[model samples]
Target: MKLHLKAALAAMLCTTMLAAAPLRADNEPAKAATKDTAAMAATAAKAPKSIDDANAWVVVGDVKGFIQKVGEVIGKVRPGTDTSQATTFLGVMLGNPTIGDLPAGSGVAMLILPNGDNIAFAELPEPKAEANAKPAGFALPSTRAEGLTIFGKTQASADAGKALAADVKAKLLGGKRTSSLHVTVPFGRILKEHDKDIRDGIADYIENVMKIQEAGRKMGQPPSVTTATARMLEGEFRVFHKLVSRIKTVEFDLDLTPDGIRTEALFIPEKPVAPKAAPGGQPTVSDAIKLISGQGAMRMAMEFNPEAITTFMEGDLMAVLTEMGLTKDDLGTALKWMKDWNACFGGAAAFDMFTPGSKAFGGQMIVRLRNPETALKMLESMPEMFKASGLTKLYEDMGAPVTIEFKKNAREIKGIPVHELRFNVQAGNVPNQLAASMKMWASGVYQIAAVDNWLLYLVGEGSMEEFIDAVKAKSNPGTAPLAAEKIFGAGGYFYTDYNIGAAMKMMQPALPDDPANAAAKAALQAMSDAMASAPPLLAAAFNDGGRHKVDVIVPLGFLEAVAAGAMKAAAAGNAKMDKAPATTSSATREKSPADQCAENLSKIDGAKEQWALDTSQKFGAEAKWDSLIGDDKYLKRMPVCPDGGVYTIGKVGEPPTCSIGKEKGHALKK
Candidate 1:
C-alpha cells in the first residue's frame, strides 16, 4: 500500500511544477484500429517493448528534466527571470540529504501483470566505482559546449522557430541532440531503488511536530484534534509497516472505458501464507441477511467475511505477532475474544445520511449469535472490553466520555424481537460563549434496537419509524446502492447523490454579508451556477478476488466552467490594456491594508522610535522598523497613523491623517 503512494507523490510533483497532460505509453496501441493500423503494427514490430500484454502501464516524467525545459522557455520569453528558486525548492522537498543523491534524467515506466509486476525502472546517471568505498546515489549529469547549440550556422535561416529550437536544445538538453538515462527493466525485476533515507527524514519531521505539540500542551494550549490524530497515526504506522513488510508481491490492473476507469490492486503474502479457513466456518451470510430498502441521498454498507479475517489473524498474523514479541497465550486470548465478538455481530453493517440539511440517519447491523440471550450477553461485555483497552483515555482527553447503556425492554420489528441500546457523545469540547453567540442547537434522541440477529440504530423520528415500518412491511431493498450492487455485490458499498445547487443555497446564510466581499460572493455564485448542471460526485471501493478496487467519477462540466472563467478574466485584462491607460508608478498603485497602515505610520512624529518600542514587545527589543520597511529612503519607516482619526489602524476607505495628538492607536487587538 505504501508503494502505491508513488502515483500520488508523482502526480503532486508533476502538477506542482507544470500542468502536463497525462502521459500515454509510447508503445501502447489505440483501443480501436483506424487508418493508421498498418503503420502502428509496423512500428510495433520494430519497437523493443509493448504495453498490449500488460495489465497496467504508467508513464511518468522526470521533475528535474521538466524544470530544466521550463527554465529554458522562460529564459527565452522573459530574460533575467532566474529559475534557480524552482530548482532549489524541488531539491528541498525531495532531495536525499546524502551527497550525490540526485535522480537521473526524466521518464519512468511501470507495468503490472498477474504473475509478476514490473514497477519503476528509474534511469540513473553513470556510476562512481571504487572498491572498499560506500555505495552512492544518483546525481545530475553535466555537459559542456554551452553556447554551441544555441548559435546556428551563418547560412542557416535565422527564423524565430529555428532559433528557439536551437536555444532549447543547447540550454535544456545539454547541447546533445538526444537525451537518455540508459534505464530499462523487464518483467519479474524489482528496482528496490527508492530512497529510504528520504522516508526516514519525513518520519523524523513528524516526530519533531509531535514534540512541538507536547510543548504547546505544556504551555496551557489544548492539543488540536488534527495534531492529536497525527501523533496517534505516527505511532500506529510503526506496527502497520511491520505487518505490511510480510507482503512480498503486489500487482494492479487498470481498464479504461468510455465512461470511466476501473482499477484493482492485489497484495500477495510471502511464502507459507496464512490459511483461509477457520476451525469451523459459521453459517454464511448469503441466506441469513435480509435485504432492506435504502433511504436518503447517501448510503454506506460494509459486509465482512468473518471466517477469512479470523483464519488469517489466527495463522500467519499470529505468527508475525509472536515474532514481534507477543506471547502465544496473549495472542490466543485476543483471537478468541475477536472470534466471540464476530460470532455475535459481524456479517454486515449499513448506514445512511439523508439529503443536505436533513437530519435523518439510520443503519442496520448483523448480530448472529447462538441465540438472543447470548447476543445480549455479548453486547453487555462490549463496553468492558473497550474500557479495558484504555481507549476511553483518548475520549477523556478530548473532553468527552465514552458511554454505553442498554435496556431489556423488548419489541418486534419485521418479525424480529428487538431490544434497545443507547449511547451519548458530547457534541465536542466547545466554549459556552461560542455556542450561545452562534445560537447553535444541539440535542437529539439517538436510538438503537436489536432484532433477532440484527442490531438497528436510528436518528430522527421519521427515518427511524420509516425503517422499522419498511422492515415490517418487507419493502426494504437492502443496503447496497442499486447500481453498485452490480459491481461489488453486497461487500462494502457507498453511494451519494445530492443537488449541489440546493446544498449551496442552504449554506448561503452562513456566509458574511459585508459589501466589501460582494465581488467574491458574486464569483462564488457564478461557480454555483456552473455546478448546477453537473452530476453529483460519486466514489466507491470494493474487494474482488483478493484485489481492492476503488472508483471515483466526477463530471468535467464543472472544471470546464472554471477554465472558461479564467480565460475570460485573462481576455478582459488584455482588453483593458488595449483601452489606452498610461502605466502608473509604484507610488500611485493601490496599496493593501497593511501597506496603507505602514504609510500612515511613517508620517507620524517620532514614528521610527515609537514603532521600535511597540514592535519590540512582540518581536524582541533588537527589532528595527527600518529593517522591515526596506532601503527606499522615502518610505523607509513603517507608517503610524494618529489615534482617533477617521484613519484608524484597521479602518478602510481613504488614507487617514497622522497626528502627534494621542499615544499610538489603542494597541491593535488580536
Candidate 2:
C-alpha cells in the first residue's frame, strides 16, 4: 500500500477510537471513563429507551435493493440502454475490504456528553474470516485497543449492537425497513461545549493569519494582496460560523423509492427565529408566493432574518474595507448607504423565470419593502457615493475597472416609478472573445420599479412591458398560487418549484443544428414529452416550531426521462466520434491577406474603444491614432494591414474601417 493510504487508514482508526472513548482530563483516562459513564447513565435514566435518547445517529438501509430498483427503472425508461456494467462496478466497489464486513441495514448511534465527549455504538454483520483480517500495511494502535470494539466478532459485542439497531428502527425509521440512509448531528450541543475554544481559534486566525493589527496603519497604504485576501476569508468564516452555531441539530435522510430517490434535511435551531414583520403587519412570504405561483417555468419565494443578516454584512464589509486601507470616516458614507438600502427592504422576496416566446428566458423579482422612497433615494445617491469613496480608483487598481450609472424614473408602469441601472466594464489584457462576452454582460440593463411599498425588478431578454404584463396576470385573483400545488401543500419560509419539462422545451431551439447533435435533440424531445404531465420538482424550507425542515421532491418520471436522455446522448456522442473527420493542424494553416487585414482592424477597434472610455468620450467623438496606438497606450503598436490598405480610425462609437473593400473580405464580419 502507498504511504498516503496507510496514513489515511491510521487516521480513520484514531478517529473511531476517539469517538468510542471520552475526552481525557489532564491525561487521566480512568477518570474520564468514570465521568462519562455517570453522565451517560443519568441521560439514559431521564429519557426513554429510544433513538431520540442518543445525541446523534446514522442508519443505512438495503444497498443491493436500491441498485436493483434503479436498474429496473432505467431499463423501462430506455430499453436499448445498457446499465449492467454500471451496477456491477458499484457492487465491486461496495464489496471492498474496508466496508464489506458491514451488514445491510447497518447503523451507528452516538451519545455526546455535555463536556464534548462522545461514545458510539455500531451494528455489524457476522464477521467473515477473510474480511475481518486487516489489510497489509494498515495497523491499529495497541494503546487504544480497549476503546475499539468490533461488533458481531463476539457474542457480547453482537448483543451490544442488536438493541441499538432495534431502537433506531422502531423510533427513527418508524418501523419501515425500506432502503434508505439517515444521519443526525446535534450541532448546537457540540458548539456550546467548545464555545471558548472555537472563539479563541477564530480570534487567533484573525490576528495571526489576517494580521488585523496592520489594519490601523495610515490610510492610503494598501495591504498586500495576500493579507487582504486573508482578511476577507476571515470575515466570511466568522459569519458562517455564527450561522452554524445557531443551528441546534441537522438531520439528513435519503430514501429509495420504486420511482426514484428522495432526500430531505432538517435544521433545528435552539430557539425559533422568525422574519421581521412587514409594514402594516402583512404576511410577506406567503403573499409573495401567492403573487407569482403559477406564472413561470420556475418560481422561488424566501424570507430572511433582516437583523441578523444586516449585522453580519456590517461587520464583514467594514473589515474588508478597512483592510483595503480605508479609514473609518471614509467608510461612513458607504456604510450608511448600505444600511439605508437594507432598511428599505422587508424580510421577504419572490422571484420567477419564464420563456417569453424566444430562445432566451426572462425573470422578475418582487421584494416587500417598508419604504420605496428610501430605496429610490439610495439608488439616486449611489454614483456620488462611489466617486467620493474612491471606489472607482480602487476597482482600477484591482484590475476590474467598471463604470456605474443609474437613470431614475426612466419610465412609469401603472403609475410606479421605474429606474434603470447600467454597468460598463473595461476589460484589460484578455482574449477578444472573452472581452466581447464581458461587454455583452456589462451592457445588460437592470430595471427596477417601486410599486406601493413593494419593489419589482426585471431582467433577461424579454421586453419590460412583457414582463410587467405577465406579472400582473399572475397576480390576478383567478390565477392559482404555487402554494396550491399539491407538492407544495406543506408551505415553508422558502419555496422553489422548477418545471423541468417546460424549461427543456424552451431550450430545445437553442441546441446546435449540426448532424452530430441530431440524436441528442431527438432524445431530449422524447424526454420532455414523457415528462410533460409530471409534477414539477419542488423544494421547500420552513420552520416547524424549533426545527427548520427542507423537503425536495423529484418525480420518478422526471428521473427516468433524464436517465433515458443521458444514455441516448452518450450513444450519439460515441457514434459521432467513430465517424469523425480528420482534424486540421493549426501550424499548417496560413492567414490570407484579407484575413490578416480583418485581424488588424479588430485590434484597432478594441484600442479605440479603450481610449474613448478612458478619456470619457461619447459617441461620434474624434479619436486620434497617436492616443490609441503606442507602446504606452491601449495598443503596443499600430496594426499594419497585410493587404497594404490604409486604416481609418472612426469616431468613438463606430467600428474602424479598412480601405480594402468588403468584396475582398478586408472588412470586419458583422
lDDT of 1 by residue, 554-648 (tens): 33443344455455545544454455334432342554444444445434323333343322222112323343455454335344332333433
Reference-based TM-score, model 2? 0.58
| TM-scores vs. true structure, each candidate | 0.47, 0.58
lDDT by residue (tens digit), candidate 2, 489-520: 64467887788877777667655564545555
All candidates: CA RMSD (Å): 18.1, 14.5
Clash-forming residue pairs, model 2: 293-482
RMSD of 2: 14.5
TM-score: which candidate is best? 2
> Model 2, 659: alpha-carbon shift in Å?
40
